[model samples]
Target chain A: MSQRPTAAGDPVIVVDRLTKHYRVADKDPGVLGTLRHFVRRKHRVIEAVKSVSFDIAPGEIVGFLGPNGAGKTTTLKMLTGLVHPTAGSVRVAGHDPFRRAARFLEDITLVMGQKQQLIWDLPTLDSLRINAAVYRIPPAEVRPRIDRLAEMLSIGDVLAQPVRKLSLGQRMKAELLAALLHRPSIVFLDEPTLGLDVNAQTAVRAFLREYNAEVGATILLTSHYMADITALCERVLLVHDGALVYDGALADLVERFAPYREVEVELEHPVEREVLAAVAEIDTFEGRVVRWLVPRDALTQVVARALETLPVHDLRVSDPPIEQIIGRLFDGRFEGSAAPPTHPPAA
Target chain B: MRRLARLIGLFWSTAVAGEMEYRVNFALAVLSSAGGLLGALFGLSLFFGDTDRFAGWSWLQALVVLGVFTLLDGLTSTLLVPNLGRIVRHVRMGTLDFVLLKPVDAQLWLSTRDFSPWGLPDVLLGLGLVIWAGVRLSVSPTQALLALVPTVASCVILYSLWFVLATMSIWFVKIHNVTEVLKALVAAGRYPMSAYPAAYRVFFTLVVPVAFLTTVPAETFIGRGQPAWIVGSVLLALLLFAASRAFFRFALRFYTSASS
Candidate 1:
């Protein structure tokens, strides 16, 4: 939402004040409103994204971060040419995304989380071959690419089985391979590591990093998983309420927004409430365990004071969790004393 | 054109290869088609037993008409019907986004991909029934060849008609119920258009052209239809096909591809 960082790198994807607004019918909450809506439908506009501007450079993986319904996916859809922007302009790979030219399509691919391109009843390889044909890839080129991808993902055997028979992780691996068979220079991946276990998640993240390094493909990835952004993206964009809130380096964002280090102190016994409260803003104090949200600007002084006065049994100082930092941003409130809802949103 | 052919060939081969894993399913499909052919023939015999001519057409001629209807309908199952279902799923689940992102023509791939190998048996059975009826009527191979002209036109018209229906799903979801109405129209073509009341006969013959799909083809073989009808059928097919293409493009403009 703030900062004017000097422009850097060759921009492969340029989005200039992109916007998308959907016209949905307005419905009443009650029976009378329902009857009125039925007689003469009232329509309302939902602005999914508004005046969003960003540039993704060649070989750079940019993280798109947002809460549900915050227009992260909408931006991706617009960039990938699946959803046309209601206003503004976008160019990916030197072509207008809205035009969706064959050349543009050939040079870009979008892989959505939990959405499948694989044919369910067919072997994963069968689906890949079909995709190859549709892409007009020479038949001879398909086998070697598929072989190499399968080996890289360690999914050669997985591809031999029907898609429905594979576990979720294996299916996702195959899904990524299917999308990448065309070797598009520009990739839009929305939650590519979703629903994967820790091992599978790590495997997919490693694969993406290697692919980007080897092929120099520009990747725009959106994920609820901070690990995905942290592991693969050097820069991150924060979207909130249908607008760009932050666009800069990931570390810069962490430094600017997450201005606190979390400290959890385990005491020898339950201490007087006044003792812990006097040292730092107590996050929680239960039985013998105590926690403090220490300001990052003064983290050293805060911890030293706590160590000198408190009966420290076990102490831990760590950067605040990604969810908390992002959550604080979305809360649109910088006063760290008060907390936002910590419960995960319903899936 | 060669690339399109290659694409279709690969899609079909992949479908067949996947289908081959379940040999029992293929066998059952063959049996089902045989049973369906037998049932249609039995119905024809039952109606013809009452008289040599029903609505001024012999039993063999009626048999030929039924044969044309079943054959076209069966072949449609091989590609069109399954593809329609796939399109519906894609539209409903927002998976159509992936389809739109492909470098190929979305409509072409959606129409031709993943045909049912099992439907091949029904096609063969329909062809056999047609030849059997031709033999009973003493129709020559030349007559069969002549009938092929209108038969091909009828298939083109039928595909266009079905395409129009399937394309509507882009604008309005839940068009599966509309295909049942099409089945009723196809059933009307199982006999001569003259078999219905005069008003109803004219409606089916000209307006919807259901009669042109089956009765006209059968009449060509029976030496009762004129060559003009063949030309008319081809013209109508071309007209409807262009209309369907336009309608599909118009409907596609409305596809939001929204996750909701």
Candidate 2:
């Protein structure tokens, strides 16, 4: 649906065959090799992004999923204009990202969790005010806006503290708030909850959810935490080896690969294991419970046979955990399902 | 322009406020900068005690060059030195991504994020030394005013030179202490350019431009600076500043495509 110019509305972010190539120096390993490299160095062109194409509608919360070096951060950088594409094009908020015009910048915010813009030696409030001033916000509007955002992140006290003194979580919250102080129309978060404890991750996720609901701003978040994608993003874009592997609803991605239901059966008493085993492959066998993996098409038939033949008190059929589903996607088991490399390897 | 000023004001006030919290550290910084200047000058005076002229300059003229050195040192400490190191660290740490995302010019933001008000004492002390040397040398009012042209040009040249060093970091992120080399070379400004041998004089003046940074203004204070000195300093400042600005943009382009 997103690939086509939909009648639904215009896409806020459009990428048409966007690509990025980097020439990297290569060196042989060893003291002798180093000496050789010093005389004659080798270079290789890295295809950081390979003709990836996608569109994001306004107010869409889309997760960019990938392993390290899979071009997730690279794509975020491209969209925000921090990194330029080697070929093709990217249009964000109706402007070329590379221009980095004030109007375009005013409508966008990029928060890279690993990189902070806050003045380290000063209180975070100062950094936030600096952000406001950069956007030319009025003095009257800056304080209240910062306070509101800081409070939303539960960082009222933390904002007054020097950034270096705060913990990672608090500092991330402050950075997030400062990046959003301008209330941009688009928000790009690259690993925003990275290196955070579970509580802090949950807090940041809740804040993002509330923020999206309140402002309806389009958010593209990249995170290693599947829980974040599952909680906020109804759709996701999966990138592997600098290519778009899958771009669809988060549920659809699982369904396309998994296409099975996990049936956990709780029995009233012990039964011959063979009776349940015949219905479906057994996942776990305990005293009172037996779990089965059954294809979606055969779910009904398997459940009926289990109930008729075995001593079953209760049964539940549910989707597998998203983490397991995603793990399988990356395991090369689904290589044919959504093949990553569209072209053959270059010699 | 007003917006830029407001942004600078915000950074300056915040840094001052933060520095004020560490009173002992602030006092020590002031003491250290002033102490460093005093020690250097003490050494200079001891050397001058034996010689009537150092490369044809009297003791007081030598003091004028030292004062310019002190003034430039304070400006670097308060403005360029801390901010350049911050930018270098950001590039290495990848925190520069946040700077590039801002609506302001990335170079502008990187160059002006800090202000060490505690370093102001060195600038004031340097000015005091220049006045004392002026009185001792019997420099007329017209000559003193004439020196202002070269003094301002020297500051411009020094800033542009340091910026070129900072710009190199967008490509070579591995070098963390480029400024250490800069600080070492800046020590050359502590003496009259003429005191060095002719070969050394030509290299520092043309290549590093340390002569314009210190000696030209000192020469003007003694009414011995040629009119060509002012002309040459202004021309050098314009050329270097433009080149640095162009280099900054080119480096940014390279960083955008190559560094990711």
Candidate 3:
């Protein structure tokens, strides 16, 4: 529930203590188990999302990060009114999302990477036309709006082609075009760049940035790729085991979780381990090169002393990669005892 | 309302354009329709072997019942099967989430999302049979137009039944064959209600409602329908349509979309 103060404006999305529980049927494997299940069924409740609260301001791009089954998609579903929340309140675009009022629906769009809304056998333009009619977009504006989005996504050529005939990247871009055709003010994207090549991922990222810039729409995105987050989002919300673990600036997260900087040094000659240890904690060394893990507070002093005392040929200082830090966080390396519940492995 | 109409227009045009990609399927559909009609006529002939009347109705009057059944079957193929048949797939694949996210009514969207022109030949042939039979019977235009009321009512009733069964996929998730069972039961509508014995007549009329679908409409076509029955047909259609809408909304409450 921890959140930094949002920018000054009426927040477009206000989620308060949102939670969801699913009553899943529990069954064992084998013929006997099937007979027993058929005769006497068993059910268990799974708490998918727990008391998650956050506010998103207009025109803000927030990254929602989580591991598999961390309930990221569940939260997005609640916000989009696709699934009802088991408990708690969600207000998006000044209306209760589950009510799904026409006005509220007109103001929001959701794009899931693994699912598509476009007709597979039809040309992409056909699906877009249906969207225009569903959203009641003016006849005069539909063509221009489509052209503008197609140009931005660089998917103008594929509009007339059947969706199944397009490449994965082209299909994803077309999905985005269909989703955004109504000019929704709030866009919820779940793994929008998933399974795309690096080049396609970068293109999608760039298109999102430019689209957000042009429309000033609020965006909440979830992606397994850190590059997607780093490129488009300045703020991030990290969820683990169905709970919000961190919410703030992405840089602040790295700063807090990873407290040391990596300094690589190339020595003029092989240096004794004791000499390098005197300046900073030695991480690794090979012949003339040494890597040091220096605390943030001691970075300046350690670098200055290294130049004064050691046979330092060239030195470079930088923070560890964000992926490594986030990976460690999820591994519970920092908390030591944050063990998640485990169920019986599926048969 | 206008937006809904426009959306339907767009949905069907796109659907037709997509189905056109397989022009050969349309030819296959026409051939199958012709073959099916011939088989139906042959089956009807079996009941009329030493007598020109079946269940107290002349051969021409019985042809009207078969025509109504053919028309409904065509409608089923053109709209119900192609659209409702996908509800199970959508529920399984999690694409229904996108359907609910749209600004339009989810039931309407699901119901009219796709159209197949493959069933058009059956519809035309069915209408032609009804007209030819009417000509042989020397029926008046006013009486023929009166038959349309029950025909439209039959269409609504059939749609509601198919839709209600399809909506059950939200819970069952794997009942694609359930509709096939319903289709088999509805096949009884191809014959007049009088063709069955007392027990079967009651069963078809009350339980499965095959009587109202074809027999009642045929009765009205030949100018022998009871006023109470026509009123009952309209009322049943309206009632079932409302129930289908309510049932769909109720089903959605339990629609735990498949995990992404």
Best by TM-score: 3
lDDT of 1 by residue, B130-226 (tens): 8998888888888889999999989888888888898888777778866677777777887778778999988998788898899888899888878
Which has the higher DockQ value, candidate number 1 or candidate number 3? Answer: 3
Clashing pairs in 3: none
TM-score, chain B, each candidate: 0.93, 0.92, 0.97
Off by over 4 Å in 1: A1-10, A26-40, A260-319, A332-347, B18-56, B135-143, B222-228, B258-260
**Which of the numbered candidates is closest to the native, going by highest DockQ?**
3
Worst 10 residues of 3 chain A by lDDT: A338-347
Best candidate, lDDT: 3
Q: Mark the regions of model 3 whose C-alpha exceeds 4 Å error after superposition.
A: A1-5, A336-347
Tens digits of per-residue lDDT for model 1 on A269-325? 778999888888999889998889888778888888888998889989988887788
Alpha-carbon error at B26 in model 3, in Å? Answer: 2.8
RMSD to truth, every model = 4.9, 3.5, 4.0
Native-to-model Cα distance after best TM-score fit, residue A201 in candidate 2, in Å: 3.0
Better of 2 and 3 by TM-score: 3
